[model samples]
Target: MARLPSGTAIELYESLDSTSLEAKRRAERGVAEPRWIVALAQTAGYGRRGRQWEQSIGDFAGTLLFAPEGASDNLGQLSFIVALALAQSLDEYLHEDQIRLKWPNDVMLNGAKCAGILLENLGQYLAIGIGVNLVNAPKGLAYPTTRLLDFIKDVPTPDSFCARLDHHFWALYRIWRQAGFGEIKERWLERAIGIGTEITVRLPNETLSGIFEGLDDSGALILRSDLGKRMITAGEVFFGPQP
Candidate 1:
C-alpha cells in the first residue's frame, strides 16, 4: 500500500475472528496510537449486539485503533466520529448523496445498508471497527445491502480504498479532536437517515416507535415518543415506511 497519513499505522491480517477484538487486545497490551488492522477475510465477524456480520468469501473488513489523548471517556463520541469519516470517504467515490448514518454507527445508502461500524473500548484506547460490503454481500439478510461497485463508476482496489479511507478518517479525527463534537454532530445530522422521521427502535426489553428527532452532543439518539422526548443511547433503529 502507499504511504498513509501521519500517526496512522496499518496491520494486515489474512484472517481473524474479529479485527476489533484483535485491536482491543493490542490496545490493552499498550499498542501505540492510531493503529489499524485490516483483514482480508474474517471467519467470525460480529456486528452491534453481537450479531454476525456475515462476511462472505470476498469482502472488506477492518478495525482502526486510536489512542486519542484524553479520549478514554469519550468512546461514544468517537464512534460517531469514525462513522462520519467513513461516510465522507464513501462520498468521494459515489455521485449520489445517498450515504446516511443509522444512529450510532451504521451507514446506509438508498435505504439499504452498505456499511456498519462497531466500537470497542480498551480502557486506555478505543477501537473503531468497520465492515464494508465490497466485492460480495451476504445472502438472506434482513435488509437490503449494497457494495461500492454498485455506485462508483470505476471501483478501486481494496488496498487503494483502504488508503483513501485512512486519509479521510485521520482528517476527520483531527477536526473532531480540535473542534469537539459540535461540527461532527452537524455533519452527521446532514447525512442522518431518519431525523425528523418516524422509526422503530428495538431495545433489549421492549420496542419503541417514535419520531427520529436527532442526536445530542454526546451522540445519543433523541427520540420524540408518546411519552415524551427520550434520549436513547443504544438500540436498533428501523425507519418506518411513512417516516
Candidate 2:
C-alpha cells in the first residue's frame, strides 16, 4: 500500500486464519527484517490468554514479524510498545485523554476496550498481533467493547489504519532498540489505567486482589497485596470490585 511506511514490506490478503499465524509460519522459514502480514478479515483471530478476537470488515488486524535484536528477556516488553502504538493510532481519530491502556495489552477508550494485542515468541522472530475495533464491536463479550466510529464520525479503513499503526510501532521500536524499556515503561505508565487503584487479577489457577502499583522495569504488573508486593508476569486484570 502507498501509505505503508518505508523500510517495511506488507503481504496483504483478503482473508486469513490469523495474521499472526501467517507471520509465525514466515518466522519459522526466516526473515531478513521485520515484515507485516495484513488481512482484511481473519477467520480465526485470537487474543491474550487464547481468547478469540472476533473479526469484522472495518476493524484493523495485522501482525509484524522481526528478529529479537535486543535482550531476549525484553520480548514481553514488546506488548507495552505495541499497546502504545495502538494508542497513537487511536489518537489520530479521537482525543488523547479518551484513550487509556489496560495492563498487559488492552486499549481502553472511554472506559471500554477498543483494541487488543497479542505477542508470540517464535524463537528466531517475535510476532506482534494487534486488533483495533474500528466499526464492529463483538457483542456478548466477557467485557465491554467499543468501536472507533462510536466516538468519531470518520474512521480509516483497515489498510489505512495499519499504515498509521506501522509508523507508530516502528518509531517506538527504534527508540527501544537505541535506548531500552525505561522510556517505553514511562510512556506506558502515563496512559496506564488504574495505577494505585484496587483491582482484581484472575490467574489461571487463582484470583488475586491488590492495588495496581505499576509495572516493573521488565514490564511485569506490580500488585501490592495485604501480604506484600507481587510481580505479575501474566493475568487478566479488572478495575474496581470484581463480581
Candidate 3:
C-alpha cells in the first residue's frame, strides 16, 4: 500500500499456489530487479522440506525475490535476518518479551510459533518467503500456534502488515550487506529460544540431542553433546525433553 523502499516492486495476487513458486518463475523469466510477490491466498503453499503451509484468507504469505550477496555457503544467514525483521515488525503489537526466535527462522510468540520464514535459494536469485498468522491460526498442527489478534487488541490488515515488514526487512538487510551477520546474529540470539538448553535436532539420516550453544560466526548451529561439540548447518530442532 505505502511506497516500498527505493526501487523495490511488489505484485499482489488475489490467489496464487505459492509466492515462492512465483519468485522462481520471475527469476527464470530474466527479471533481475528486487521485488516482493505477495499472495493474499495460497492454494498449495509449502514450507521447508515441502511441508504444506496453510494460510487462512487473512493470513500473510509473501516472498522477496532478489539477487543475494555472499557465497552460497553464507546465504543461509539471510534466514536469521528475515526472522529478526519479522520479530521486530511484530514487536509493535506484542510485548517485547513475548517474541522469541527458534534456530534458523521460526518466530515464536509466547513460546509457540506465530510465524515462519522459508528461504528458497534459486541459482542466481534468493527467495525469502515469509508467512505470518495475522488474524487466525490453523488448529491440529503438530506444534502449538498463536495469532496476532489473540494477543493484541488491534490486528493489522495483511497489506499494512507487509508494509511494516518491508520497513524492518530492508533496514536489517542493509546492515547485513554492510557488516555481515555478526550484528544480526547478536540480535537474533537475544530473541532466540532454546539457547543454552537441551534440544533435539533431527537430520536426514539421524537425530542428535545436545545443549543449544550459541551460533557460530557463519551462523551454523553450535551444538554441544556428550560426543563433543558439533556444527550443524541444517536440521529440524525440537525444544524441551525428547522421548
Candidate 4:
C-alpha cells in the first residue's frame, strides 16, 4: 500500500454494498479519525435523497471516517467539508476550473456528474462516502454521467486514486477544521455551477422555481424567487429542464 501524506490509515476491500455502512460499523467499534475504507466494487450504493448510486464495474467507491474533536456537536457541516476536499482532489487530476461543486455533495465536471458524496453519522464519528466514475458509468441515467477516463485518458488504478484522495482530503480537512466553513464557502462559490441561473428545485412538499443564488455558510442553497430569498438545505436541483 502506498503511504499517504497525512499518515491516514486505509482499509481496502474487494467488494461491498456500501463503504459508508462498513465505516460506520468500524466507528461503532471505536475506530478513530483519519481512517478510510475503500472498496473495489459495491453491490449496492446510495446517493442523495435515498437515490441508488449505480455502481458499474471499474468504478471507485470509498468512505473516509473522521472523529474530530467535539465531532458529535459539530457534525452538520462535515459533509460539505468532505465535498470540498473531493473537489480539490479532482482539481489535481484534471483542470482546476473544470471541477464544480453542486450544492450539498456532488462534483460536476463540465455540467455532467463525475462524482457524488454521502455522509452518515455513527454516534461519535462521521463517515463520508464517495463514489467517483472512473472507468464505467451508468447508461441513460436521469442526469448526465461521466467517467474519469473520459477526461484523464490514462486514469490511475483504484489504489493509487484512493491514496491520492486520502492525501488531498487530509490537507483540505485541516484547513476546514481550523478556518470553519467560511473558506470552503468562498471556494465552492468560485466553482459553483448554475449560480444566478433559473432552476427548478424539487422538494418533498412542493416544487419551487428560482434563481440559484449560491450557498450559505451552513451549506444551504440560497435561492432567489418571486417570493423572495429562500434557504434550501435539501432538495433535488434541476438546471436546464425538469425530468
C-alpha lDDT of all candidate models, in order? 0.78, 0.89, 0.88, 0.79
Looking at model 3, which ten-residue stretch has the lowest summed lDDT? 1-10
lDDT of 2 at 54: 95
Worst 10 residues of 1 by lDDT: 1-10
Q: In candidate 2, which residue pairs clash? A: none
Per-residue lDDT tens digits of candidate 3, residues 1-243? 324755577788899999999898898897757888988999989999999998988888999999977778888999998898899899898777999999877999998899999998888999998999987888998899999988877788777788788888888989998998899999999988999999999999999999999999999999999899999999999987789
Rank candidates by lDDT, best first.
2, 3, 4, 1
- Candidate 1: the clashing residue pairs are 198-243
Candidate 3: residue 205 Cα off by (Å): 0.8
The TM-score between candidate 4 and the true structure equals 0.91
Q: Give the candidate order by descending TM-score.
A: 3, 2, 4, 1
TM-score for all models, in order of appearance: 0.91, 0.96, 0.96, 0.91
Once fitted onto the true fold, the runs of candidate 3 whose alpha carbons sit more than 4 angstroms away are: 1-6
Residue 167, model 3: lDDT of 86
| Candidate 3 clashes between residue pairs 3 or more apart in a chain or in different chains | none
